[model samples]
Target: MRITTLAKNYFFYCVLILTLFGQNGFVYSQCPTVTNTAQSFCDTQSPTIASLQAVDNGGGIKWYATATSNTQLTNSTVLINGEDYFVDDNTGNCGPRQSVTVTIYSAPTGANFQGVCVTSLSQATPSNPQFVINGNNLQWYTTPNGGTALSPTAILTDNTIYYISQTNPDTGCQTSRLSVFVNVGLVPTPLGSAVQEFCNIPGSPPTVGDLVASGNNNWYLTSAFGIPLDLSTPLVNGQFYYATTVDPPCESSIRLEVLVNLYEPNDAGSNGNRSICVNEIATTIPFDLFNLLGGTPDNTGVWSGPILTTNGFQGTLDVSTMTLLGSPYVFTYTVSSALCANDTSTVTITILGLPTATVSVSPTPSCSGSPATFTFTGTPNATVTYNINGGANQTITLNGTGTATLTGTYTANTTVNIVSVAS
Candidate 1:
């Protein structure tokens, strides 16, 4: 029984020693190993509590603002810049905890850009940075995160979203939270000008052409005041046309204006014909070309005839000196419209010569002694017929004296009838 009691006591003392040694082993182990390093973050970034925990990472962690403190850090605690944090792995109050530095910096900020245009993507470049946020270092990039670096003097040539960062010149750190959007503007290129013609006829519809703009460019028409015109279909004539170029995703546009002229097509008046007497041209009646041919007051015409007929723009023509006592004569009067290439309408004037007739009898009623003479007067060398004593008609031709004489004997109460006709 004495040996059994001594063995049991020895075993209890050994277990007690082992338990005390085990508990103090980690507590006194070389001031809790810690290898914390400095970290930087954006002011807008929400850091997790785990971020505040030391890399030493063992046992219950405690954080403090000073080297020694009774207050502990909750998981919901927020971290800030220029703040010193102390960490400890021990479960109770202790000294010598790991330390981590926290830094908070601001991201770059700027407004959107516009009116940058280019033909290709390779030529794209960002304009000078307009940083709304100020920092130690300024830098631009092609993307929101990481991409090609852009120079401060880079010329923006196309539509793009460029990223910029503001480093805390003190810390040499930057963030890519801010961006500036640039747009490509339309090119102000004129399609050129041309003339279009339509006759005075009807059934003319609105006109439009696709040559105004190239592929992928939408074409639109507008008035001088920049009022939008119909684009679902064709365009109209006689209207001042202005071609406005529009490109998508671009807040700006360019204009190419073209002029359109509408005029009345030339359709000369119908050919005119009229009769006139010799030396009887002057008339009170005035000829109005506008009322005569339904043309504008600006119509012009030329009269070509004998005696150097007057050729003037006047509507009425004086045919007095243009005609003479002769056979049918032709006087051409050509008139042109304002819109015609030349005058294609002509007016003809015809004149007739005067005819004369006369009758005379000599040695009146001499009974069978001598043949009574009957005379007929008419145009030179004209033919005249006279009937005597109701007998068969006798015909005679006027000689150079413009008179025709017929000889006949009176049988009983002589009766004669004389008439003249032009040859």
Candidate 2:
């Protein structure tokens, strides 16, 4: 029995040793992992992945993707659309590695988002000033190139160039923009011009103190309302009238007429003291006057009548024909024109009565070489001188006109000169 038990023990020990050696001799193989190497391509309506995948020997797998070429799957994660895709090790086949590609479709949901804006109209001095546009961040360009753009609120900058576009966001198709322009200016102001015309015989010379006054009927010195005007100041002969207003560039003007006046010589006379005989002619008096006051003439004045008119009613009056002049004769001289008229009074003219006297001669008649004497005379108060020749200032003592016989002359050859003196 003992020997049989020992043999069983040895056999069990040998079996244990053989099992250990056999386990040590066997080899285990591991599979490579799979990964994604590229992002997906667009196929019809969906996205399919372009790929590289890896399977590890321990039945683990990972996948990666990149936008760039030649990227290794070990360092990259596959992104489809905007979401990230990771390696799925759920079906683990260790030996063979598989590849997967992720596709980005429908353009990541929000690419190239866009909006439009317009500029506002701006107020300017000129009615047609320029309008400019401003926009938010965008990758847009002008549609028509070198003209003008429509901006945020339709406000414009002057003399600036621009380009506007009506473009699609996703696809870069655009519509053409018409050109726009702005200018600067305002409405112009209006103006008026004027002239004048003169009257009074056109070209004839005027008399002194004579005035030619114009009438409104001839369109002289007229207002816009056609009212007759007495100017604030007397009108000057050769000057024009002018007035103005301050609205936009607008004014008025008209031709005016200015009448001129003339003045006469100041020949009005004044009376003086004088005396005249019954048959003497009238003498002219001398005087002159003028209107020192600012008085103008009344055209239709009347003078007291029964007055004789000659030489424009300016002749001398006859006082010499009055036979009796006791208290002195008085007369008046009157002068007139459109300006002024007045009468001047004369001083008295007195007349004296005549006187009577007698005359005589000296020397008697005698032949030549013979002498005789004869004498008679009035009071010496009535004395006389005699002359034989007709010399003007020569005087001879008047012995008598018959004194030629005393001198032995044949006939009386003497004339008498009388001397009368009044105190």
Candidate 3:
């Protein structure tokens, strides 16, 4: 009985020793060990690839601590797309007390192959960037010039002008646009001047050009209008002319203007009498004409000559015929020109045998905005009273030894009646 008890005790002691020393015999700890907690898979064409870990749980006489080894990869295995590979826990770093799971998944594929082609890679200002292929939807990222897919189609007019600028981090600069150039296939038309005034002179009609038109066609002028231009008429100032289109697309319109000039006439000089007889003497009266038109008037007339000293015309005509003793006669001399139609002057000489003041009252000419002046000359100490339209409004009386001058302005078209008296 004593031997039996001792043997049982020895057996229990042996089991305890084995349990303690079994764990400590191995230098490394008895923990599940994997080559790495995480890893990145390299981009490769291979379908499948595998890896491994090594570990030891126990031995015959001692419990070996957990041990790990460097990961080993297997490239020969067939890699299924979109599939995962689970490592065997028992055959790897997994211990009897602990187990580890490693998940493996296939990587995504590369971008679709769109042949190297030129594309408008731009995001126009005031317009978003967009990309389209034959008007089809596509996915692209933001590029240096714009984003991957351009938004809002660009309005291209000239098909020949195909240029795109781009920037990239890896590539300092580039223009990866395709070789095919986009053609808008249209040109812009030019514009012509429009006339402000119209003229009736056919020969000297003001000329205007092609007004602006749409499309790429060239422009020209024509006589398509039924009313032909009066080529014989001289284009006067303040006249407007029109032009008809003569191009392939006919019936267009244009205009032109002719500017006019305003001129002031020379005042009549003082004369001794309306009639002179026998050896009557005549003196040349000095006259001053203010050309206010800012230029010298053309004195191309039988009785008109240039002043030679200033912007004025000077001339003298013999009126001795009217002053001759011949039956008391009256004569009138007229001076005019075509260049300045509104500017004309007349001088009247009357051979009065007695003292008579012909007080004639008539309505003044109607002018839009011209100044009017009234004066009395050729009389010795003449006193005069004038009434407009015989009304009290605008009536004046003046007494002077020489010529009396009075001037006033008109705002609009006006009519005036004048009553001249000499006493």
Candidate 4:
């Protein structure tokens, strides 16, 4: 809101004080006195006769655009910006006519200049200026009313304010210089936490933001979350380098955090190295088994050992060797990741505990003539067998989840024995 002005000094009409009081109202050879005055207004507005001080002190008043023009201004008049006008009295003894200068001021306003500091002068000049001069003839200066002209939007690496001037060309009036505080703040210092990777090229000096001190950025290796790493700190797998911005002393909020991106390899369980039950895979194994340890994902598996079969995480388990290998069976496979060369995971097979077998008979009493139903409960995916009075053994596969049932016709219920075997 700072303003510079060119103002006209005020003058008291000395002639009016003397002649109006005199007893002899003489139309003598006294000069109709005129006071030299200054005129100023914005280019958007017009000037008036009273504003220009165009009235005579001798009591005879008439305003004209020119010294000799007949177009008399009986009332108010709108004078052009920065244009001139003359006023005189022809009815009374008058003196030399006086000329008034019209001054059209250029309103050079400094708008809110909030911007990021740039590295170069060219970068400082924005597409749109922060300050605006209302007039067409606009000029920019480094110093107040000094130096060569510059663009209004220019930004400097250092924090400083630039001066600007606006001119009213129509009235030939130039306003005093106004200022636009070009708050050229260096892009908030890039802190180490802002980076995702770190090549650790010391002295080569990677650019980073200094969140602690403004306009100064430092490079540093950081922890997984971006905290600066200690000097000579050993880089860890799947870690990160951070880059953050320093807060300016005046502006506390100018801050930023970014990742440098480059720390590779995941930690311990990153590969597929977890255990799975052998019996759980009736038709296909769980897909997440590949990432049991941690992985690069998109991996494949090769079944080996007594099963001697090839498969994937979702492939069927080897039930044939369940009897020999028994429950809690162990197996291994190498699951690799993508992109990077060294991404292998761990996936193992574990046969779960076998469920016991239980038999339930419907129509328990001697059936007389109807067929009796024998229901067997066992581990999912296991085989169930039953003997009816030692007549013969009937085998049926468990529902792979629940119970298995068997039906036989007998005049009287002799005996029902059931057995369950799990792989």
Highest TM-score: give the candidate number.
Answer: 1
Per-residue CA lDDT of model 2 for 9-121, tens digit only, reads 99999999998777444212443433444444332223322233344455354442422223334433334544443343324322233444443332111112111111212
Report the candidate with higher TM-score, 2 versus 4. 4
**Cα-based TM-score, every candidate:** 0.40, 0.22, 0.22, 0.31
Candidate 3's displacement at residue 161, Å, is 20
**Best of the candidates, lDDT:** 1
Cα error, candidate 4, residue 373 (Å): 42
lDDT of 3 by residue, 296-347 (tens): 4345322332112232244333444444344433222223444333333433
- Clash list (residue pairs), candidate 1: none
Tell me how many clashing residue pairs each candidate has. Answer: 0, 54, 34, 52
What TM-score does model 4 achieve against the real structure?
0.31
Model 4 residue-pair collision total: 52
Question: Each model's C-alpha lDDT?
Answer: 0.57, 0.34, 0.35, 0.51
What's the C-alpha lDDT at position 201 in model 3?
A: 36
Residue-wise C-alpha lDDT for candidate 4, range 331-365, written one tens digit per residue: 44533334223333334555466556777778765
State, as a TM-score between 0 and 1, how close model 3 is to the true structure: 0.22
What tens-digit string does per-residue lDDT give for candidate 1 at 1-423?
999999999999999999999877756553444565576676545654556635443465667776777677776788877787777765635456767788777675556554444443334444333234455477777777767667756766455676667775444556655676666554444355544443332455335553344434343455334455544444445654655444554312544556555455444556556665453455524342223333443345565554344326444554555545543444444655544444455455566565566777787875655578777777877677667766687677888878867677766677777644555
| 2 versus 3: better lDDT goes to | 3
